[model samples]
Target: MDKSYLDNLKFPASFFEDEVREGFLVTSMMKRYWASQLKVLSFVVQICDKYNLKWYAEYGTLLGTVRHGGYIPWDDDFDICMMRDDWNRFFEVAKKELPESFQVLTLSNNEEYEELIGRVVNCNVIDFGPEHMEKYYGCPYTVGIDLFPLDGIYPDEDKEKDRVARTRKVLKALTLAELADVNNHELYLLLKEIEKENKVVLPLNDKLKNKLRLLAERLYSECDVTECGNVALMPFYIPNNDHIFPRKLYEDIVELPFENVYLNVNARYDELLDLEYGDFLRVNKSGGVHEYPVYSGQESILAEHIGRNPYRYTLDANELLRSVQRYIMRMTRTVDKDTLPNAESMAGGSCADSGAVIKKKAVFLPCKAKWWKTMEPLWKKYMDDPGYEVHVLSIFYYDSDYNGNIGERHDERALFPEYVQVEDCEKFDFETIHPEVIVTQVPYDGFSTFMTVHEFFYSGNLQHFTDELIYIPYFEADAPIEKGDKAWTALSVMVEQEAVVNADKVIVSSDAMRSFYVDKMIELCGDETRMYWEQKVESFEKSAETEDDSGRINNEDDKSDMNAWNQFLGKYAGRKTIIYYITIAFLLRDTGKSIGKIRRALDTFSDSGDKVCAIIVPQEQILNDLANIDEALWKQFTDLVEKIKTTDNCIYDEKGFSLGYMDKWSGYYGDASPLVRKCVQAGIPVMIENIDI
Candidate 1:
């Protein structure tokens, strides 16, 4: 390889002499370690660039770049920093894009690894030390790069000083807590006193470390650095020794060569580096070279000790590390035999183990007949699962004035086998069931059985007893169907937002549907809620087999009527069939304007002699509104209906036949409806009244 890159650097003779003395094994190991870290660095840099995230080389990594033109020759770690915004964004993007072998470690994510900074760990290779063995035990120790969040400091001098002081205090308390082991009675008593005074409980473990890290980051990020003139290198290694710099040093970023790739670095590196390390160029012989006990190719050792493949738990870094620690402690007898917790105890010995009585209760509530039809297959799956006791409940109360008359309690007994118990929510003892998983079609707090189910579950009241609130948001209403008054539309939006926010998991019909909800959730709720929902929300395209078959209607009577209607339309087979379906709410409220528009369009089609037959199916709601219509408007509507009925090429299907079965027909012409999407999906042409011809 080319050694020309190292020619400019004036290394002391001792450095090469020490390398020679250590032999080829140590030198080769160091080279491999550096190479691995560089690979990680490249991976991270590529992701940041793809996501448009700003990051810069920092600390020892930056020092190495400036002093050695690459890794410090002895250095084994890489460090980088991003502003809090960029840092958060990087993690969000990196979680999905990072290679399978690479794992992202953070304070919140990995319990055993306690640090304010995050790490991108390479699981393919093992790199651990004596300290790692002691702390991480059975965990798979891997090569990783550190990622620090550069937080903004308060512009106000006094406020900044106060913030730093408070952070230092928290850090001190955390350190003391860690040091206060079971043997250190005096230290433990001192920590207790400190905790009582500060009103901060300090547990000497991962929890305390996490709390302190959060506290420090929060305190540091209190002020907006972009708005302010200063920034702080927060969660710094030393307490009370925060390195504050002018925000200008961070604003202008420049790319610098580090190994084979270029890295983003603060433009004002001279000033920043000088502030960080006084006389940075003058390398102290003692401090310049640092070494740590690194164990290479210890994957087998980790796997053998942990009693499981270390790589399997890479995604769950915290648990992986904890397992490692526990295994090491068990092997070395470092932990007291009487005090040490058992595997069962550490594993929570609850629902995790097999053969444990699976008390998982799942309740599926179908608010409407259509919803029941859509979710029936899912109900059967849950029924088949021995682990789950599934309760299928239906609420059969419908408003007679609005939803037509509901008769016979809508029995679902015939749909399922005798083993399945289909109960009515009105009569069912929901309190006794005590369901852990609530699966509902009506996810919102709206004027539906959703409210009734919510009441039954005591949802959003008292303690949240339900474990998983799964919402199957199958219906996609892109725009408000309501005319004039937007109150109903607003209410619908609110309900959807509530469902998006509160539901533990949202099952969407398609990826398009998922994206729509994701955008809507983000718009309704902030970024944090959006992030939560993104993780929880998933897409499962409805099976074609589950969809209502073509020509199938709700009941036998409706089916016969639709068949007869189809037979009637068959007489006009020579003509192009145009299925005109419109909501009456829009028709009546538009003062006959919508109908007039349709009339004109139809007249034009007739005049053109295009051999087109129009089938106008008005919504049931429109038929109901006819009773309230004034004489003049009523006459106008009837005249239009009469004209269409009398016209040789037109037929009125009054029952408003199921749109799903309209595939045998030619095209759709009406106001935009959710059914239009279905028509498009079925390869039927759509012509909206005003928008499309």
Candidate 2:
């Protein structure tokens, strides 16, 4: 070796002299114990012979024979090496050939245990399960035979060197493999997968490792495994020449005396020994020179890498160390809802907060029911004014069997028993029951500012009505059902429809809920600010534009002369029309039906020769199922392509027979501007589905 090589190999007092010493000592003792385990070796040898495995004693086991005639007195382990091809063959044949007392411990013994084949282990005495050495030290321990496969080497010396230099790259990502059969440990399987050339990649951040492991598995499924090249095993030294004896006397086996046993050495023993210890057969004694435990032969080299990167090991570490830290800098940080910029960043649109205009009128305050006591404070803050004409839309008890018809059976007290009005909030348009602002309690904290900015920045029209739409995220905790499915469903519809794009901007009632939303939203979107506002603006603009009649208005003054909203009210004010159509439920719940019936329905209604109109389902899952249906059925459904509109209708409170009452109208609940515009442009006729009241 060059002088520079020696210098580079110099052991550090901190890492080598101390940390590595104990490991070496434990490993050496283990190897010695293993060598003395003649019964175990005899069994292994028999298995190898019976299976015609071309195996060789490896590491310290080989060293003991060459240097000390047998196991080094202090060594405690044994190892064997085999060429990849031979190892794979042995694994296949040994299953039925080996004695039942001793099974083939290779990974290929079972698909679930494949990782074990690539790992190096201290084979345990099968008679005694696992052995704990930490009783002698302060850590946990287990025993198993050490095995290393000799993989084919890349011919390029540089590439071979690069492969060796890369250490423990997949160490931190080991996981428990779900196996069908228990042939070996799960850790081994994880390691085996990583060792495959195609599986290696730069590790993700520590926090993402677990999730990435699943992702990696999925990704690996798409990779071709045959691309891996076979690399040579033990490339640096000649196999037949023991350097101490010179090439003239190279042999496969030679006799030597050990502490209490005699052993045979391979011809290249001296060459292999010299590479690991420098002075082969010179150290008549077997012990670690450093402060750490000694490892027999070149096994220490393998053990060092294994200790640091267990995923590369044939097995997984029983225990691991992890650290976590979290800190919150401040409390009760409130962002001004109106301050957010528009969404015009790169996307040429402003955030939803822009141009939000809410027109409010006198609102009548209804008497607070027992259930609404929790909402009194907010009502006072935003609605308890004398001028506010709070219109009391009929309030019915949850038990009230409200029929579809708006018959004159409304109880005044039940609807509006209390008349206390909020000084600021007002009501407008009792005929349409105009709801300029929506108020609800959100269940999280730290989103007041975010909620505000997200609410209106998209319209370039932030007006006071934006404030009227208050949200209290955290109210008293209620079951999802008790929370009023209708309310949350309505909320979801609004969001999905772009009715209120930045629903989070509405202040949540409970601090705890606010905090939850803040964390969850941050976790989901990463960039909470941009994502929250961007989505809101997009939805809001779409809704606003859909609600407008710009094409119909020839002049700005003419359009301004009459409120577009008023004109819309005048046109469709009380017109009730029956809407008979096939519902999406046909696909989802129509499981009992046959293909012929489905096709008939599709041919006539879904895809008539004249026009194709099909009932669209709200659930995408059902939609996908429809897409995957049999081709014949699909053809029938698609026959009337032109007449069919994929648009869907949104219905709420369908329990009461109120199909289309004057006081209650059902229209598209998504972005009004976009949805309306779509209908008008397509001449699709956006109408309330109802029987004329």
Candidate 3:
């Protein structure tokens, strides 16, 4: 490899002269750093040229290219963006094409960075102490060209809102995981809302953060840029849709001169600059995103570097050129071999990049957060090991007709522990993932609950997608099942289960339970397969009093959300709270009798001498959704709601109140619905009474 391109680079002595670009001083230090960054940009341009990839000058870089031919006088690193597909192509080649010291950084490879962007960098480690390194990716300065991925934009109003909302939620999740600025009011509120949506990424560690970064990547890639009319800026850290723009603006590319070489900029730069910033040709001396030369502090580190490495970085250009000529002839350089340069790239090119390097051994299904405890011991054993991976694909379930979801009634992802890499069943790709081992807690398949996993997720079907299937009964493993004939009856259904019979391994909570399973399976199999059944049925030997058991399921917001929950629950205190939840069943069929039931419940509570409090909670979104509906029966229902609010010993709860507050109620009087199951999961007593109207 030729090293001459890097050998002859120099910062001219004229840069030290009192010359200014945008009324800002062009210091020798800034010029030298730009020269170093331009070299890195040249290397990236080489790779992009080799692959025929596309990237456009963006943000301040775009403003600089039009107004200043290269970098703005006040800007630090260059800003660029590529369509996500192009970025993915770049990643494949970047790994091998980059020079030895050069590296492309993304959340995938760099834990220090939380943004969904990339940086093609060289050997430079800014030593800003541990605290600074932890917060600002080693100082607030841009180390290299910031490469943002532009993803596809959804045009349909609903789809666009959904796409933006999901990205924003994930952004909030990333913020909570980083906790970079817990004091930001907007961030604090968004994190509070995002965690309420899903807590699967809770108790965050380096691993779960990577999972979230990839999850957002998946969401961003949901739309194809080629088919879409617009492209969206990939990061949704801020709450706005203004980053989206028409795709036609970027269709034509013009490689304009940046420094020594050409870099990409949209051909319609005039219109874009006008649209983004009105009167873009004018000099904006104060709007640079970064502090000109230094990072946060007033210290000039680059100037210090110039004086520190006087051998080659001298302000005397003639002296540098003379030394270079002599050093080339001597065939040896005096610079230290290990000194950290300012991200200086040489050639064509974290916690150790956990995103790309690691792969999980299996995907586990816990159904809901509570069932996770059933397989947790084994899960931790595999998770703690370096080579194994466990993805908690929290699969949702519905009845045969798809009427009611069995578990995960509400957003159970919020109750999940942090550090667990959890995702929804909708994103699960059995064919693509092709997990080596599938440890499932549900065994009854399609028979027992009229409620089974989708045909694709059935354990019998899952057996085909995985090399090994392990069935650990949710009931026996977590807690004991029903006593006597009910136990035997449930076992009869469970023992003959396709999940149990076909599984490579069947785990039970106790040896006694394992013995019963082995004996029962052997009896069902004509006693000829006693040895097979015994070997298949193993036990975790977990004691009846499960030590260190998880308490996440019952108490969704034990402490993290105590403030939010207590504030909601303060009104109905000092009494036995009973939730009278109204379901959406009335939307389909309203007979007026259900409204009568609601009135009776509230009246009975009022007459109980204020000892009991009844909360009328509605699952229907009709409160805000009702408009231009003049139905007489519905009018009576609305009147009842108003009465409940003002009546003694009663409260009308809004739809968005935390389920945690509802779970704290002593009893539930509601329809046999998802909310009822949620109450059951919380171990609160329940009576299924319908509110029809």
Candidate 4:
């Protein structure tokens, strides 16, 4: 490496030449960035040479040294790697010997930095602008040289594998640990994945980062460098030969001209480049990783130093670094809600703080009363708790032909628990109420389904009215469907509904369903966003539970529905009961056979007059649009369903969905619909009958 001009590294006039190469103009700002980076590199070389430490150009730096005389024209950063031992020694020397203008930064020195490599940076910053625009700058932005450590491979194959794997995980442990904060999702799931990957438990606490750091230090440095013939960079390395390169590459070093001065290169730079990139001779500038003139995000301080060509003032290096540290601390510090930027107006673009309430509200937003079973338990939990004021906002909705033809207006607030407060959707101002939590059953944000909530009460827009928007699927997924199934297009839409996506939490019926949604989401957005979906979806074992298949409420009660169920039980004390399950699928798919089956099943069971009482359980959705659902088929079941009232032994339930077909159910009868799936799930040994249409 060139050291003759160490005290006065000359900036070449040719180095500042701007030329359009590869179809674009190379800006003067980019040339200045290269000059600043070379200056930082010279400082690092001086320190390493003084201490007898070794580092060779790596990554793009090596690529540039072998292919281009300097940085690959468009590349913005510089990289070099040293054997772990030399890396350690260089750090020790560079800290004490480097001048004030250059700052050696790593995880140890900078608390906010989470990068895997160490950096030697100029204390001064860099600014880049659109050729036409100006005045904006980035804070903490500066030209820097990245330093990576190459650790020796253990002689034992198993041992090397273990070391490489652990090192990779420890590096992951460091990065993942940094991601952990107050939000209990994303980073948290990855910690569990770490334990699964390496059997290492990284707990979330104050010292997790320190613990992982020490572990990484021990794992990488404990191996003897001289004993091992092979070495690899751990973060990029794995338990394979593909990433490991020859140890002799760094044993002998050669100098290569980089810009105006010669920089150190591995003696086997040819072979090293070939191993790193299959065709090292190929000139592909498409692989450049960072944005040109990458801003350090330290603009306020940079504005002062950027125009330093005339030397307007002398900067106090210590105080300047202190200012940077202060800015970093301010950026990284855990901020409280009141102190957060624009925090006062965080609530729906309003500046006035929503005042404290005596009792925070937990609103139950149900468009239809039948959908209440899924939300009733939560309402009860909040209702019984003194801390929350529970209200059932019986939201208004409309059933449509989806061509703008509104079929029926459903404002069913009649069956809610009388003991709980029922709010008038029109009069109970959501803005004034400012409920702490809002639980909605319908998640279809109009476009996904035929049902549409009153525009003012759409779940998608409700996010602005409350701090927490919770969505519980009003219906149940009897079984998961394959990705290519005909129903999946609509089902996928339901999964990604604005109500489901915008809500703070989505409570699903089962883990199987949750996994189904997650897998579907992966298909939709690729695997990168799986962690987000995992955290967003929740499986409910008990709380916010929905009713089971037999239209039976397991433990939840919608006062009037429960009363209707209990009243039906009173009349049929000594008789066998048949729950004739009816889903809209039956009416739509079975050429009026569902209507025929109900009659046949009822009449067949009614033959035993005093011994049996048949109950026709039509699915809840059939109640609203049954008449208009199929002008063709509605004529068949119209008179049959009404037989429940005229016949003494036959029973009809207003909210049959609110009841569970448990031990008392003698027969289960339904078409090949989702209710059959729910029947098998209930495990009630009721006789199954599928009548031939």
The Cα RMSD in angstroms, rounded to one decimal, for candidate 3 relative to the true structure is 31.9
State residue 231's C-alpha deviation in candidate 2, in Å: 7.1
Runs of candidate 2 exceeding 4 Å displacement = 1-36, 107-144, 157-264, 281-693
Rank order (by TM-score, best first): 4, 3, 1, 2
Tens-place lDDT per residue, model 4, 1-693, is: 232343466653334323333322343345656666776777788888788888888998887765665676657778999888888888877877887656787666765555556888766444343321111111124667899988777889888777667667666656656665724576566567656755666767876776566556657665777778887776566524465787865655556556666667764565576678876645554455553346423433454566422111222334333433433443355254346766335455543345654677888887666566666656666878987988777888776421334657777776554544677878778898788888887665555213567776666578778877788877644323455432333245356555665566788767877877777766756787577668767887554232443244333554555465557677676677767666543465455455676677666666667887767676544555555546667666677667756766777766774246455566666532233434454564444345463
Work out the TM-score per prediction.
Answer: 0.36, 0.25, 0.38, 0.39
> Per-residue lDDT tens digits of candidate 3, residues 1-693?
111232243333333222234323443334545655766666777788799999898987887766565676656767788888998888778868877657678777677666677888654554434443332222313446778888887668788677668777876667666665445566556645655654444333346566667767777777889979988776642266567777877875655545444556775565567667776655544454444443323234544754532211112334323423433433332244355442224422232343355555688887756667778877876787887777778877543311223542334676677756678767878788888778987665654323456666667577777766788876532221423322333244355566676567888877767877877766656566676667667888654344455545435456646666546657655668788776433432334465677678777888888577777787543453232232565577678778987888877887646454764678988643345545554678877664432
lDDT of 1 by residue, 1-693 (tens): 222221132222112111211001123234444545665666788788788888888987887666545565434668889888888788877878887767888766666667677889767445344443222222235767889887776668797677666666666756765766534666566556646544677665546556766665566666775777767677662354658777777755555556555566664465677678875544432233223424334644765677743322112334323423433443355346566876567787754575667557888876655445546556666787888888777644322111122223344444433344677566755567657678766543322211123344332320143556677753433322223112222222333433444456677666755665666555445565455556666877556665644124335656576676567777775566788876543454346365678677667656646477887787554565454544566567777888888766777878765344565578888753444545665678876666222
The C-alpha lDDT values of all candidates are 0.57, 0.33, 0.61, 0.62
What local lDDT score does residue 135 receive in model 1, on the 0 to 100 scale? 27
Over the stretch 1-693, how does candidate 2's per-residue lDDT look in tens digits? Answer: 111121122211111101111111212123323432443444545666676665566667776654344455345555666655566665566546544444345333333343333332233231122232211111112233555555443446675444443222232233332322223345445445555644544333332344333433233222122223432233222132121122221223333333333333343343445555674433332243332222222333444645631111121112100000000111112243235544466557544447754335433222123324444444554454544434333232111101111222223343322343233112233235434444433221111111211222221122233333333322233112222222221122122211122232334334433333343333333553444433222111112332242223134534453344234334333333212232222332233342334334334442233222223222222233345533454454444232233222211121222222212222332111122333343444553221111
Report the error of model 1 at residue 125, Å: 6.5
- Alpha carbon lDDT at 540, candidate 2: 10
Give the C-alpha miss distance for residue 691 in model 2, angstroms.
Answer: 99
Candidate 4 backbone clash number: 17
